[model samples]
Target chain A: MTRNAPPPADSGAVRSAGSSGSGSSGAGRPGFLWAVPAAVFFGLFAIVPLIMVAVLSFASWDGLSDPEFTGLDNWRTLLDDPVMIKSLWLSVLLTVLGVAVQTPLSILLGVWAAGHQRNRAVLSAIYFVPLLLSIAAVSVLWRAVLDPNLGVPAHATWLFGDGNLFGTQATAIGVLVFVSTWQFTPLHTLIYQGAARAVPPVLYQAAQIDGAGRVRQFFHITLPQLRNSIITSVILMVVGGLTTFDTVLILTQGGPGSDTTISAYYMYQKAFKSFDYGAASAIALLLVLVSTVISLIVVRLSGYDKMRSTMEGL
Target chain B: MRKSRPNHLAGFGSLVWLLVVGLPLYVMLVATFQSRPDYAANGPLAFPEHFTLDNYVNDLNSGFAQYFLNTVIVTVCVVGIVVLLVPPLAYTIVRSRGRATTTVFRLFLLGLAIPSQAVIVPMFFVISEAGLYDNLIGVILPTAAFAMPVCALILTGVMRDITPDLYEAMTVDGASPRRVFFQLVLPLSRSGVSTIVVFSALQAWNGFLFPLVLTQSVETKVITLGLYDFQTERGVDTPGLLAAVVLSMLPILIVYLFARRALVQGLMGVGGK
Candidate 1:
């Protein structure tokens, strides 16, 4: 916790004082005026709703009538509700699968792409195609492409992997995770690619001169150099994993034993389908609390705050 | 740097590049052309034997044109508002660096960790209560709201990367903070502006959960919602529905192609990964 205080005090404080001293009186300046709309917008929309979720979670309302105070009811139900708990479990399962699959694959591709400059532009375009496509379009596109009776999967289920990908519970969530990882792997690759390219070539040359093989160079030079990027991208992966809903909504609709149902999807179903705004709000607040804690832990363990603050000052 | 030979990667990678991304895009384009009967006869993967404008024509009949317009309106408004608003905010945060600035910056950073899923619960009530529910204005407000945090954060990183000497020179010249803002800050931060513009536009364009939950009527529905409903309505007509999908993707994809490098740099710059 004290880590947040370290680098900012050293550099940030100095910068603030230096700028304030060098410039004229800072209050009532033009820049602060420019920030007013932004601050207000976030207040009304971002932070206010955040507080609203907290309050609404403790009230009973159908989103139309007056919300009456209902302390601990939603929370107690959440604790015992198998559907919500299962969805939460599924979200964690997804986070694990996503991290496990995306991290190394992206690193490898990123390394390969970093060195393979001959087709860099073309390859980047190809890879970034998925990133550019709309999520809704991606959802429908994959649905058609992966259909058992209709598309590529119909012809090559053995090689293409699943024929009835969205149909069977056993393979449904796995397939959903795979398609998602494929679509998003490019983004992770880009991050890793940027990180890898930032490393100087001299490190590799010196290691090579020391009789370090390519694999050895990768482990010692490349991996260590990319430690921050890895950690950062893992945070992206975990947050993304936890908040996943569109793919499930469009592709599976939480079908085949509700295997692909994530916490977000559960919230969506409760609020939209069952029309239980109070319970849904409870889920919302819980997810935010849990995810905030989880992300902070990830950042702490990854040394992200320590590394990034120093990096920023540099 | 010494160049490495292609080895066998040339043939293998070329195939993969074509197969992995190109195939789905190809299927989509091909499926869009084949008539309904032709689609059924040849299946989803087969090339269209008789290509026609029927799917496209049918899609326009389904009010897809209005959906396209709605998407453009919302996306452009969100992007414009974000670009116009965030720079000044980012400038103040970087230039001042006071207690208020730092606290504000931290608040924005906290928004990055909190996805819109958490806000949608209360947001639904807020929008409906304000009588903005099922309205495009309703969608635009919240979309821009969610975008503000990340946009401001990225723009701050960019503005901080501005050399302090630039500010010093402007200050020494007796430049008003307003002049220093427009005459200096704006010109220097063109790349950053474009970065947030492309970023927010993408966010708005691809926004699903918001448009899905907030907008109820067809008149207010953006293209993403439009596309989803189109698929359900025309699920049997694979090519027709896909044609609509392709149409919805075209505008954003066109922007992406021209701004690909900048988009890549923007995403990387934001450290969003």
Candidate 2:
């Protein structure tokens, strides 16, 4: 696992950013001649389509005719659209709530699971089930589960109430949030567990000897030690929340009255359903802008570049 | 040796949390096994007294199997192609420090940021032009490409991790860069490769938007798209839809169970702090 292996001679000095005494005796041409096909494929498929998206974002189209140049009208409409506005707000709300709810729960589960190594494998396997399923499938499953009349929630209502629970907006959002957290908790738990595993056992021993109670030791030792993983998970949750489309589409299709609509879902409806490609592109551009700004801020605030280098170092 | 109050509290909390977490899944499983009348009569949270496999049987008979195969084919092919393509690009980017490398990386990132939903119209034209309009490869190609940016970014991160020492060492020993890449970089980057495979496969298997717009025939239909079609066709065969969902999710569930470690490792790479 160590990157500190013995360095070869010829091109060895070229890599002397770290390893010592491995002189460049066999120096020849710089190596990198076999990267052609992959480069071409990535360029044609990934790189080109992105350029197309940016260019088309400004073009006015009715889906059949050649795209017409309509300047910032699309952009202007994006700013003025109420549906877009509401959905964006909803996406932000969901992200905030999702992070707030999932983080502590994941930490608790991870800490508990990590401590009892005996059942760790079995527990981790069971926990990761939701991550593997398609978002659409999860939605479908939950929809049936939350069916007020014939669904699972109706059955569970004997405990809470024998009323229509799924029809209410707050309850619906709560269910969505709960479902989202269920899928995402396993991811965060894995992250926290990974970090916790990396914490040296001697530190915990030291804490125990210092009369640190379990809760006290967790806050003082585990939480502080897992700062990077916590930041990573939160950022991921935020990005995922912002870009969410599939589950919402399958579960509610923007809901009984657009209550569950998110920005991405709204845009999809605009472009495809309404044939408002221009408006859709404009909305998508704005989404990209928001996500980019948020991502950059996250990268900076989380010290992501430095952490990436450090993680690589490890 | 100390008080047991905290332990009791922790145990109680764990049980409550487990129930909170497990309830939805519990409901789904039970509902899937219940008779339609029984499902309608009883609330979802209750367990089914009679375990009926009829829902599953109906789903399997109702083209769910075909959808499952299509999804598997598309996901496997997309993952295969991406795995074949991304590593060498990453190696070149890491090994060759120049404008070209920087430009390529930036290009991939641009693709990453530009949501594909924006350009579905042009993409459809392009797909048609290539005579792949209704083909799974049409979906597969774009899906694989869309995934490239993130994959390349991740692979670049991983490739960067493969201490330059190994490649340099290989070169000093008179091995060609190709040999070094195949022998050293690929072998060293096994985890990253697995990460890419798992991520790409999930994306392809789970993708809906592209397939929904691009393909028209049932033959080219993936599970997500197929489920949509089934829902549209049947309106609301609730038990059958749930069954299709359970079937569709089987592969991912198995993969996640076995490779949770790698998936976590991969998540760290993509969701890197």
Q: Which candidate gets the maximum DockQ versus the true structure?
A: 1
How high is the lDDT of residue A135 in model 1? 79
- Predicted candidate 2 versus true structure: per-residue lDDT over B1-273, tens digit per residue: 233234666567666766766776776677779787776766565679888999999887777777788888888889988887787777766665434555666556555555565456557667877999889899998888877777777787777776656666676787755566667888888988888888888889888878977898878888887777666576356667777777887887788768876776676666543
Give the runs in model 2 whose Cα sits over 4 Å from its true position: A1-33, A158-166, A200-206, A297-314, B1-6, B42-50, B109-125, B157-165, B232-235
Structural similarity of chain A in candidate 2, as TM-score: 0.83
Clashing pairs in 1: none
Clashes of each: 0, 6
For each candidate in turn, the TM-score is: 0.91, 0.86
* Per-candidate chain B TM: 0.95, 0.91
Ten contiguous residues minimizing lDDT sum, candidate 1 chain A: A1-10
lDDT of 1: 0.79
